[model samples]
Target chain A: MPCRMTSLHQLLASVLMMAGLVGPAAAEDPNGARRKALHNMVVQDCGSCHGLTFKGGLGSPLLPDDLEGVDDSTIATIVLDGVPGTPMPPWRGLVSESEALWIARGLKAGVFQ
Target chain B: MNLLRGLTVLIATAVWCLTAAADTALRGTGDLGVIIERADGSACIISTTERAILSCVDGLGDLSHASAVFSPDQRYAYIFGRDGGLTKLDLLERKIAKRVIQGGNSIGGAISDDGTLVAVSNYKPGGVKVFDATTLEQIADIPATYGSEGKLSKTVGLVDAPGRRFVFTLYDAGEIWMADFSKPGAPAITKLGTAGKLPYDALITGDGRHYIAGLFGEDGLAHVDLWAEEPVIERILDGYGKDDPAMPVYKMPHLEGWALAGDKFILPAVGHPELLALDAVTFKEAGRVKVHSQPVFAIARPDGRQVWVNFAHPKNDTVQVVDVPSLKVVHEFKPGPAVLHMEFTPRGHEVWVSVRDADRVDIYDARSFEKRGELSLRKPSGIFFAARATRTGL
Candidate 1:
């Protein structure tokens, strides 16, 4: 069972790496618990203003279709810096750059949808 | 022939017994309430007396930031959804009596003093829409237009006031307006004047005498005395938290849960791990208590002896209880991950807390702080009791 689990993890890691969704640092801990924490933050914290379904609320809609034209880097920057003159607060210290990118990719991919 | 008659009688008796079991005995809803299951877009009708969920009503859309208001009779609940859905839920039947997509995106709602109208605050179209409580028909639409450009501003902090009036603030416009429905169809709007920069949410005193709005862009809160002949917006605690370096706020502090403890108002300070106390009479800074983190809700128990506080995200696992008399932290404990909201029983004996991530609602003895019971739910957020029907600005 241990050997089979190792092969499955490798297969999943390779697919994620090929998709350019993870950095080298994140790859070192592919199935880390921090990933689960980050996912919860996106759903609960970010979802507080942006709708839970990402349709729209006080914050703008963040659905996959809504973010179609936006790039992952821009999304990551917004996640870190937040939009000025609004209730969106910066998450620089709370979320790392790579994690923000991961969240951005997940958002655009409708992983949270 | 005798055998066939016996069989028919037995089947009829069994069917009657099954029907009787399906329909429980009629009971009062005074000890009943609703909990918003945010993730599933549904609400659970809970019995506070029994500390259990009676039924779950589904199909309410986008309950991410949902809130509810009860009718004068306390038999119906008006649930305001983030997707601009207003659902009128019947407590006895445990179903959505009527639902309507009133706007594109909505914040919250309030019911008229006479229970004739329900008003929704919208963000997409940026206005307030009033509807008939029973029929769910549009009564009037008041746009939150401000400035020289006549731009529409998003409305927040919508609450019902005495004499069939609704009070709310414009987020982008920095103003508060009161819609008086004395004439029913024609609403007499009174601009209460400038609130601060980005007046996010507001609350009216239990006596319905004062309306206070918390500012996001500034330090102080905007205050208005509703009892005055000509209500004017006054700024209080205008220079609060100016000495400390600003911290990034993960969750905005909600003012609707502002607590009135004894002679003071215990309010959660934005971007600060503190609860600010103001003299309820003079509106001056009375005292401040350092809490665990940025407080999301500082709610006082019914008798106003203790105030319970919950923090924002990441630090939200902890809840602290403050003694109103000494203005000190009396107790602190971790219920579970993601403690979204807390509601005290009408008499302030027991408090029901919603642990979202844990999918459970834990009931605690308000005085002893003992865990009394628990009910499993799905991502519960807000717990509104039928007792709110009697309060001024629940």
Candidate 2:
């Protein structure tokens, strides 16, 4: 069972890496709990303003096509600093820089749709 | 005799099928309710007959916010969408009666005290628009123009007060205005300036005596006494969040959900992880009940014994039920990943909670805090019951 679970994890990592949803370095972190929590935050919390499907409700869409040509750093900055004069509030206190980058990458890669 | 027996069996079968079909149709007169399917941009009318789930009628509006005001007879629902689309939905027919683009961006609206007028507070045109409830025809347009430049500011926290008046706060301008339609033709406007900085939301008391607005640019709330002839304005809960620094506010704390549990008002504290209880009559601080995270909706059960609170994001999964008298957290449960809104049965025996991420609505015993049942839904956000039909400010 342990061997089968390890193989499944490896397969998931390979697929995510190929799809650019996760970088190779971050995949080695072995923080499944954090990833799950962040996934929940991106889909449920961020999904409040952005639609649950990330198709844009009050905020703009976070779909991969909508985020085309938007760099990782810019996305990360928006996640941390937020857009002023808008409903989008900053997430710096809630998420760390690396976690924000992970969310940005996942959003850009259409990981949460 | 055999032929008669056959006819009887056929009649029994037909009666059985008819009964089953009637059970599905379930909705009796005045039992229709609407649930906000935010993702689908539609409001699903569920039959509150036996708390049964029905079907959704589509094409409500673009990015439909959780703002729905029912008609006086509880037949039509006035929904204000985020993209400035105001659609009137008929609950009985389960169809959109009329829709209009009242502004470029809008938040929420209110129905008049007499229920003859429906008013919408706008974010784009920065004003309030009043329409006839029956025809959906525009009657009055009052802009929230500020200062010498006459620059408009987004209007928020709109509530229908007594005496045919709609009271709201100008968000950017930090002022509260009341438009009285009592005399007809044109609405007489009264502006109370310098209420505070950046008033985000406002709420009027059930008696329509006090109109309070929560300020986002400042640390306190502005309370206006509407019954007074001169209309005295006072700031309550001053320096409530002055010591705390600004944090990431994922969702703005809603003042509308501030619960009136008996004489005490249970409000979600801004920039803090606590629920502030204040004396409803005096507007003085009563007690503070600390919760899991920044509380969004701190609503009281109908009996006013317990206050159920759903927090802002990151901790939105957990709902804490606070004992009103003791001011303690009694029962806390993690409903799902994204718990959006909750509504109690008319008597407050059952609380129907919408778990958005779970794609279901869970019914819980309000007293025991036990899960009773669950129903499958699609991204349900707000669960508004038909009991709001008789209430003044829901």
Candidate 3:
């Protein structure tokens, strides 16, 4: 009975790791300090062109409803690469791909607003 | 006899006290200014001489990109807010005299040469609205409609010009317009022709003879000699940055703060970490000074002896001072994280810098390069003094 129980526990651990729920790589969420810095950048730097409330100013509105039809990856790509021939500039150097993706998801979820 | 003497002394003392109170009530606003508390949506009325915040007035909504212009008498400040709030603040009363929501999104504003009209540039509905300076009542609305499609263009860089005119650039239409309010209610709008690609911001010379707009979509600037018989837009410094690979611009360079040091105009190069010097006479490139990362505001001292440059994000913490004659950076220092603005005292003896992250405004001696004093406040930006009342296009 003890041997059977140990085998079941091993199977559960493998499943969790495969799902990226419990792994070293999945733990790379921007730590607390880094997250705070990113939050400030969104409110202060991004808020310069986009209204602080994300209602829209020089830049388009960034509210969740405003970004309704756009997918997360598309938003992330625009955040990283920027739209051409516009005032929007790329953030490739300032933010990592994963971090940009995180920001994109957050924006879609109204987490930043 | 003793009672009579005591009453006489009391009367004299009362008269003296009354005189002192009257003098205090008549204090001048020459040394007073307001600093925008961006995060708190308030402004601190400060005294340059005392180096202290006198009073804070709130309820001026969404000051993320606020700018102000002083009345001719320098007693009232017309504040333009990002969320379309135009507030008339009474400096003497230390309170908001009037507030009005003029548009959906406003960029900035300008006071008329006569100080009778206040004009604002809007982005959302895309137009310029002029208001009665005293009553805060809408007088005229000039839509920035352009192209065959009749699309409204975002108006930027509105400045008060001589002859009771307001000059501004249309971002989407790539054109400049001058609204002459000489006739008051009926403004004569003149299409000043194409300003290359996207004219983001502009500045008028201290003499108000030249209007120069910086282009964003291309590496050039649009210049208009307002004194010309038939003023025409001329592209200057076209393709100046073609040789260099473009870098991401975290913040757009502010042309309103373009420096006029000596005979050269010190301007922040778009998307590059350099300050381009243009001859104030011919408007030709004279030199370039490479400095810390992407320069935002390159403002000259009031005496035009030194130019101070501040940078954009990542490098935004630093400030560099360049001596005009040598075109060389003389001093570099970090005021603190997120140094948003620098305002020189009316005489240029000292500079007040707003350190946003630190929630403090630091005063430094312009010549000695030493810290003078600091005042704690909320996240502050854009420090404007009453001295702007006499200057052109602050």
| Candidate No. with top lDDT | 1
lDDT of 3 at B1: 100
Spell out the clash pairs found in candidate 3.
Answer: none
How many pairs in model 2 have backbone atoms within 3 A of each other, for residues 3 or more apart or on separate chains, i.e. clashes?
0
Write candidate 1's Cα lDDT for B113-140 as tens digits. 7889999999989989999999999999
- iRMS of candidate 3, Å: 0.7
Q: Residue B211 of model 3: what lDDT?
A: 92
Question: In model 1 chain B, where is the ten-residue run with the lowest total lDDT?
Answer: B18-27
Better of 1 and 2 by lDDT: 1
Shift of residue B187 alpha carbon in model 2, Å: 1.0
Candidate 3 — which residues are off by over 4 angstroms? Answer: A1-26, B1-24
Return the candidate ranking by TM-score, descending. 1, 3, 2
Residues forming the 10-long window of minimal summed lDDT in candidate 3 chain B: B18-27
Off by over 4 Å in 2: A1-18, A21-44, A47-75, A83-88, A93-113, B1-30
The chain B TM-scores of all candidates, as shown, are 0.94, 0.92, 0.94
- Where does model 3 sit among the CAPRI classes? medium
> Which candidate wins on TM-score?
1
Using TM-score as the measure, name the better of candidate 1 and candidate 2: 1
Per-candidate DockQ values are 0.61, 0.20, 0.56
lDDT, model 2: 0.79
